[model samples]
Target chain A: MPDAGPPGRRPRAAPAGRAASLRRQLFFWLLPVAGVALFVSALADYLVARDAASQAHDQGLLDAATTYAERVQLSPQGVPRDMPAVAQRMLLAEPDDRVFFRLVDANGIVAAGGAGLPDDLPDGSAEAPAFFDLGEGQQRLRGVAMRFEAGGRPFRLAVATTTRKRDRLMAEVLLGMAVPEALVFMMTGLLLAFGIRRGLAPIAPLRREIARRSHSDLDPLDMAPVPEEIRPVVAEINDLFARLDRALRAQRDFVADAAHQLRTPVAGLLAQVEAAERAAAARPLGAAELAGVAATARRLSRLVAQLLALARAEPGAPLPMEDLDLAEVVREGAEEWLPRAFAHDVDIQFDLARTPLTGSRIALREMLANLVDNAMRHGGPGGRIRIGCHPADGEARIVVEDAGPGIAPGDRERVLERFCRLPGAHPDGSGLGLAIVRAVVARHGGDIRLGESALGGLAVDIRLPAPAP
Target chain B: MRDARLLLIEDDQALADGLSRSLRQDGCQVAAAVTAAEAKALVGSRAFDVIVLDLGLPDGDGREVLAHLQQLGKDTPVLVLSARDGLDERVGLLDLGADDYVVKPAAVDEIRARVRAMLRRRRARTGQTVTLGRLTLDPQARRAYVDAEPLTLTARELAALEFLAARADRIVTKDDLLAGLYGGDRDVSENAVEKLISRIRARVEPAGVQLRVVRGLGYYLQTGDA
Candidate 1:
């Protein structure tokens, strides 16, 4: 049994390898997926911004190359004239960057302006100039090269600028796109953690309701606040509590009934002993008075024994089952009760057969004993009591019938209850015999029926399941 | 066996006192102990012919006393008395070397009779004659007498009488008598035993003895006034 800890204390930790926190599991499952999604989208945004920034910077280089190309004057022999220094300075003016230009003849000579400019011509016509990078490290520049014809000879013009402005623009786009996305990602993770905790909040009240209850408080838990997913679980717990409550009440009532039943015989025994003592003071106690005391003691002893048998036969009691022949159990019972039958002037006959079953020997013996006892009590003097055992319809059947007054059909069911004696019952009966029989029968998963016998008395028909073939 | 020494270890004060008084009246010297410790002390100090031990005791279990007696190499028979009447408990106690087990709430007469039976079994090699009231049987001679007068009986009748007399207070089944008299002879029916009992009853009844028939069981011999 799991320990139900004391009130106001946290429940003990679950056994190793079984601990599961739903809140942590949900957060763990959700947060990483959200983080990866945010990361992929942010990376795409950075790439798009970088592409747009480079396109704008390359367009400015193309404009500068076109302006420098217009300034060049070429002789008919295809020798390009150098640009005026003032005009060159005006075209290359810029802040935070240095600009360079070159006009090269088709022979690949350094025609004008700064040397070492890349002269890679565009694959398309001169109207569609191509952009390229030149130099290394901090001197890296973006340049565009184009071809033009003067006097029917091809000449190339190149313009390049240091890349500081383009680098600054890319950095701006990265800062603008990544910072807010990261904030949103962190915010979503926090919300997910909080949401999971709130989603699982209903379990707290259920736990508290259970922990706050006293041991004897077996009331069903209130289900209004329970979540839909766990309602079935709570309902099951409530069902168990209801069963426990019923069993507890039955136990309490049985104890009270037993006490009362025990008191009657004990009180009689004490009274008889006191009377005998008083009588002895006058003279020796008479044999009749002595017999009275003995009778009371015997009744008390029988009651105690019956009560023990009933307790042992109660449901959930440990029963040690073995393969046994029911006919043998019946025979033993008949032999044990034969003396009583003789005293009552009742004739007992047996029709025993080998009826094999799996059952507790002691309990089955007790059951048969009670049946015979009941038969004799009601069968009266000179009554014929018939006991039969055999296998019928895949079950071991035992029938005990008497030739005396039988119970009415309506009252048959009521007599199986503990201490439910019929009106005007024999004074000697403790009213527990049939109840013990019923309990034993029920424990063995057998069925019992009380009906009018062919002999004119009650017939207790018992059917116990036979062992599997 | 008249003055056999007996020890009774029971925790209930009133029960112990009453039982001891009754056993003493039955012609035995009975010593009483209220706890396991006291029982062990008494067992170590003296020899008892029989011991009636209750399983439940205040200081310890009655089994401890049984174990203690075993350690001392005492072979005195122990009759266990307990409220636990389960078959397993009875078998376990007997396996633990107890001579017998009787459930509690038992009649004092029953206990006395069991103690006497144990004593008789211990000395059974002598084959002592059994006497109940005026009816006595001399098994060695295959004879029975009432008031010291021998009654004429055949071999089968004598055997049946002796069997019933030996188990006087208990009801003997017809099968038990058949086995005792005929010893697996299938030709002899139970009806033959019934006729034999009637013949014995006719002779014994005039001598103030009864060969009582318990219907559906077997027979019991009631010696007059016993």
Candidate 2:
């Protein structure tokens, strides 16, 4: 109704592919969060498992060192010796680890076993055993060292073992903890998908409802059990249906009226022809006897043309725009109505300047033709009419002013409506000219202003925006 | 078939039947085709004086026929009949070599006039001059002379007079005169055409040529000898 102005600038009613579109949005928003949660939980599990394994491995190493120190014995010359192998094996009981033990006396002599071992053992007192990690290239070992009395001499003993079992325990913990979390994550993802699908379940029914309807069935869509989020959308669609129903109804009524309008003249034509044939038996038929038929036929032709022009001028179905000089369009108007004005005893004066308009040539022609016709109709006998197109504020200004009885300012708007004629106006008009003109001007997104002309009748001024350079 | 053979290509049966009946009553053979295919077959079968083509044919648009006619180099005058009142459609059809177009619910007389006009124009295009009484109209020269005396008339008077003279003894509707002179796109009224005829009539009536007015139909130019 508002000239379908800036068709491309209109906002979309709703986003397309609604359900899949929402899923895509949710996936982008939520997947990263779910992934981070999985990573954090897995990291916590690995850290706890590694800490517990290190503590347990260190405690076992200390116990093995203490037991070796306790079983020391003098070997005839008071050299400290380890306890029996079977007793040492009983104390160092670890299935997946290799154990080492060494006892060093204050004289720097190995009394037990220190063969091929690193010499960086921590010096310790009897009160506390020092547990430390020893690096053997890439492989790591945990060791415990303590000072103890052996064969009535103070000696330092250290026991060490590789961390292969501790690492295996941590790997077991990582897998054991992550599997359930991952399963839960997958379950949550599936549930989310199910929930989204369930939320959008109404779409299929809506589609089916729409598809099942006949073309003429313009009833509002059923909103039963529609999701709350989509209520506004369905309501909007229903509103559109209501508007369409009204428009169609109005169109049907108009067609009925137009049909009647057409029948009047056509019936008159047939009757006149029949009468003329009848008159052939009496007196010869001529223009005087067939005046009604001729007049109606001509009226019918103009009415048909006007009706078609009105239909063409509707803004809903827009014509493609083209760049043309406004001066050319004005000349077309002049060409159409100059003779008409002359016949009406009106003086048509043209004050021309070059102005550019980007519009459908036919539509602008219709608009200007109407303006000229309106002037010729209401410009009174012997009135002077002035028409022009000039540039103003980067817009094309087209105007028609006539020296006749102009309408009061209040009635200017009413005159533009369809079938609206002023009291005591000429009967020759179909009252559609201005309506078609307004429709065309509206479609072009141009402005129409009706005011008092300097020539004393009506001044119809139109301004259309200039196209891009 | 009569000498003036007309082919009507219209999808609407009622309108087609009515138009064909009226045209047939007017002493012309009217061939009514209900579809584009039928119309196409009918057109190629024999030459028609004029083709009243409806653009909204069931099988296809009538423009196809226009294209087909052009391709075949058949200069048969086509008068497009359409419910579409769009100027672009009318202009586009005319540009496609259609002689003219008439929007429907058109009066029977209007269609008859258009057919006659198209046929006349077609004849005129073949370099023919028309004679009514002693007044002879040379279309090529665009001149009119009454019994060897060249009449002094404006360009518009000559146009109106030429249209009337071509259909002498037959009625020419005022609407037809308006169309013939000013064309279909203009806003000139019937009064304008009437005024032109009277002015031309003032000069030609004394030259033994008589243009009789039928109020509903229009002027019938009768030769003094007739």
Candidate 3:
């Protein structure tokens, strides 16, 4: 399932203040980037320095080799002759860079050049040129030998210079090019880290704001002064809080109203009994007084009972949820209500799907009971009632239908309100059954709707969440 | 006449006045308190046979009065009266030791019946058991026997059976059944209790004990041998 969510993702709801979080985020994001940049810069500098040093070595060798090839001339016998001392002066004008020169004949002998040439060197003519390094103690020379034709004969010329001196010069040039880059790399990384930390400093205030709240505080978050990047999430969280606050308030009010309403009947009864006892002690009670007191008290008891049942359907109230066979629940609820229906001449029948569901079995029954109760109260005598449950797709559906006075389309929703007994309906009801049913349905995360029944009475269709395997 | 001392704790003046007149005619010395505080004062000051305590009072709750009365060690049976019929409130007061309870707008007779039941319960713990039809109950023994054979009943089962037997043949809704069974600490649905009843019926009906459930109203244990 996509692993629930990204394991290291930031929480969906970030606090309003982003300073501290931003600072942390800056540290999180910029540290690696700065490190990468520093590494890349260092690599580029190293590569460039290595290439420059190699080029310097090759160029210096080529320069010395070119001087020897250009100055040495071949005699009639193919012997290479050195230039006059004047030409050598011009060539050796740059004294720090020492140069060596040699010329050899076909016999591989030093015909005219200096004794620096190695006798066993490999042979080559005109177009072929080669470079080799010669080591003498701690000193090394890079030599380039090339063959040339003069006066109809072949002659070879070789030039050599100390590689150590070349390398030292190349090293100085490379260091000059690399020093600034390395310093800049280090500085940039440190600066980036500091900038990231500074940028993310606001998040700490946001975290504090969130951590300071109590669970009961559902007020909207104070989003002012939050960074623009984080405002949307804060707004969404605050909106959720606002909604939750309203829902909680409604629930509290509902309970309070229920408690307040139900207490009236019980209180009335107490008051009446006190009156009756005192009246009997002082003088004999009249028939009217006795009947009035007795009838009201009975109604009070019935009302209290109904109110209590409705309250039990409230959220967080105990409705022992169990894995139940839906068909069985319907059957049992039907059987229990059968006698009452029979007394009222209401024919109650059931057609069930036998689908097992997960819910408070009691709540399911109460929901059924209320439906049956409503049918009896409004459907009047001789009304026929039908109960059915069926499994469709991935959900279970339960329907209760009656063959009498179905509710009007407009009033169907209204009747679910507490104490909203229909106008001109039977007075015996406590006016909370449907409300209780709705509450129970809501608690079970089910949906309930009233419509015209097949029997021409009310039909309550409830769909509950599919049971887990 | 006027020898029975009746303590009246009610918040409503009109209802209180009417009840005072009715109880006077019923032959009792009536002391009416307007609030729970007043009721407390009355309880501290005088003794009465029955205390009709209202659950909703101006200064304090009627359940508080019931608790205080219980703390006093006085055996005065209290009948809690409240306009609210939520099972929790009724069960709470009852659990707190109020002997009986009646919802508001009650007929004086229901008040008298509850009061009488409490008085009767207080006078003797011997008649704890109740019998209706083929069902036999031993309230003190906390046992029920059907057809002379002992039927094992849990405390709740016994209370349900007892409640049904007490009002034998009359309709008792699921809400009242729950209130009478679990009281205030646990808020159980009528359907859950009905299931319990169903299970109880499954257990008790095998022995020819008939516990019939009325669809909309509640269950009834008929007073017939069959």
Candidate 4:
């Protein structure tokens, strides 16, 4: 069994600072609001309870004043009589407070009961009474004063009580409102904390899934279980993984193809060398045999150079690019091939225009060399080859045409693949020329087309995207 | 080139042995070095007609040897022999004072031709005549002679003969011939070059100078019997 090699090192996630917890954040935010609600409700309850307690106590004081007024028989000078002792005891019967009463004639003098009551009572009518508060500290009182006519004479009655009962009732009301509200506020906080944790629970499994995955695992994450809000993010990551998978596969395929291509020429060269050695042991090798060895070695060298060019031209390969004229590249490439063209008696012509573009000079040169080489190989001896470069429609167009048997439309596409040599092709041909041209075109964001040339041969038309003006 | 001295710096033992043997057969005295240290020592101690320096060496990069050559102020033409086929590396080596750059796995014939071309260019600068076997060309005076006898030739014929003689024992293509003859002028057809080559062949063939045509390729000039 083949080893899968060492497991891919786990990707180290970015270092995280002390992150804020969503649950804690929610709880902290709700605490102050809950507390404010409890305080406001307690204050309202205290206000309402105090009002009711004071109203009831004042009513008792008014009743006691009215009773004293009714029971009193006015003397000839119209002085009011004190209340009866049993009546007084009944009026003062508050367990949590002390009560007092007084009677006064029209002259504003106290005539009975407690003499220390305030004489500054508001004016009162026989049918209506007035309420007032008097004194300070332990002697503080809520009082009611009333005026009445007995035996056709007028008098004023006053009653007062301490505030202890009102205060005690208010305290009970405040505690009644605050305790339950506080309990409910605390319960709400606990529920909020629980809800926040539950809402964020799905994220943990997602993180664990990612952390546990190997680098080679480029499969997409399951989006069905992902939260709807985070689904788009996961989908984006899946898209990235798909792209990476494709690039990795392409690289692996290229490496394999290059190795396979290299093997054939190297083996041939080695065989030729061995044969030459065996022959040389018997006699000096003839020039023909020596030429055969040299040709094999040259073929191997050409293959190696082509493989390097293809690797450099592969898409996504990093290249140092510069602004250069396509015409210059075409000229240099044509010059390099002029010797071979002359050797074949091929009339090679170039009509170069200053087509400006941003590209790797080496890659462009290699691309041109391959195109010209392909033309020379197929164009045959005593044929013509035309190379042209021009700028058109915001692109740099380069065309290489040869005068030979042009490729059929159906077979043109296949020839661009690595090692796809056409039947009856030259034995020395490596079949990587068109593939390299395609890769270089693809790398430069360019398009290549094959068509029948007017010169009665195959024409390669390439258009590369130009740099923006 | 029979008396020319060459220094070959390469790490691969088999390749060095084979290349040195081929060069020696070509009548060049070759000194082989397997490391940069040896190469530097040889370059400093002896004056060579040409240095074939490999970029990859066991002791250090071949550029160190190039730097050493420059430090010694030696004007001997240095030809870079490397496995790197990248244009940038070739341009960089040339910029570093290398006279020529040839990718490895090249034929010994091509290497010899490049070395000859480099030496020819050097000799041309010194106004020396180029000789290939029985044929010798005085390029400065635009004249050719077969065994001390001046050959009557037209100016274009002499230029063509000089071009072929300068690159003797190598292929010369029609386009190269036309470009060499006329520079960037394309008005001259390839038929004209063929006619010119045939005429020159007829004129020089009687003097032991053979102008051979490699069908579907180019022409080759041979000075002596093959």
Candidate with more favorable, higher lDDT: 1 or 3: 1
Give per-residue CA lDDT, model 3, range A242-324, as digits (tens). Answer: 88898789878876877787687767767877888888898998776667666776676666666666667777677666677
Per-residue error (Å), model 4, residue B137: 6.0
TM-score of 2: 0.67
| Model 4 C-alpha lDDT per residue in residues A1-469, reported as the tens digit of each score | 2433443454445534446755577778977887787778777877877788888877777777776666676556555455546445656676777777777765665666756675567766767787888878767888887787677656667777788777677777777877888788888788878887888788888878877776678899988889997899889999999998998788888788888988987888788888889999999988877787778778887888888888888876678778999987766554355656666777777777789999988899889889888988898898888888889999999998999899999999999998789999988899999999999999999999999999999999999999976
lDDT of 1 at A207: 87
State how far residue A240 of model 3 sits from its true place (Å). Answer: 1.1
lDDT against the true structure, each candidate: 0.81, 0.75, 0.70, 0.79
Tens-place lDDT digits, model 4, residues B1-226: 6768999998888788888998888888999899999989998899898888889998889999988998999888998888876666767787779987776766676677677766765664455787655667798888888889897889999888887876664557788898899894789988999999999988877766767775445676643321
Interface RMSD, in order shown: 3.6, 12.3, 7.9, 7.5
TM-score of each: 0.73, 0.67, 0.58, 0.69
How are the candidates ranked when ordered by TM-score, highest leading? 1, 4, 2, 3
Model 3 residue A232 CA deviation in Å: 3.7
Predicted complex 4: CAPRI docking category: incorrect
Q: Cα lDDT for residue A351, model 3? A: 70
Query: Which has the better DockQ: candidate 2, or candidate 3?
Result: 2
Model 1 per-residue lDDT tens digits across residues A64-157? 6676666567656667777745333754455777777777776778777755555453432487787778777679888777787766767777
Model 2 lDDT per residue over A1-469, tens place: 2243343445554767664587667766676677788889778877877888888777777676766676667788888756546334844455677666777888888877775457877888888888878876336777788899866778888877777777787778878888988887887777767777777777778866766665557899878767778889989988998988887786787687778778877898898888888987898787776787668778888888877777776746768677888876776445335434544567677777778878888788878888788888887778787878888897888888888799899999999987778898888887778888888888888889999999888999988887755
List residue ranges in candidate 4 displaced over 4 A: A1-9, A18-197, A210-215, A270-290, B85-91, B130-226
Candidate 3 achieves a global lDDT of 0.70
Query: Clashing residue pairs, candidate 2?
Result: A287-B214, A287-B215, A290-B216, A291-B215, A291-B216, A294-B216
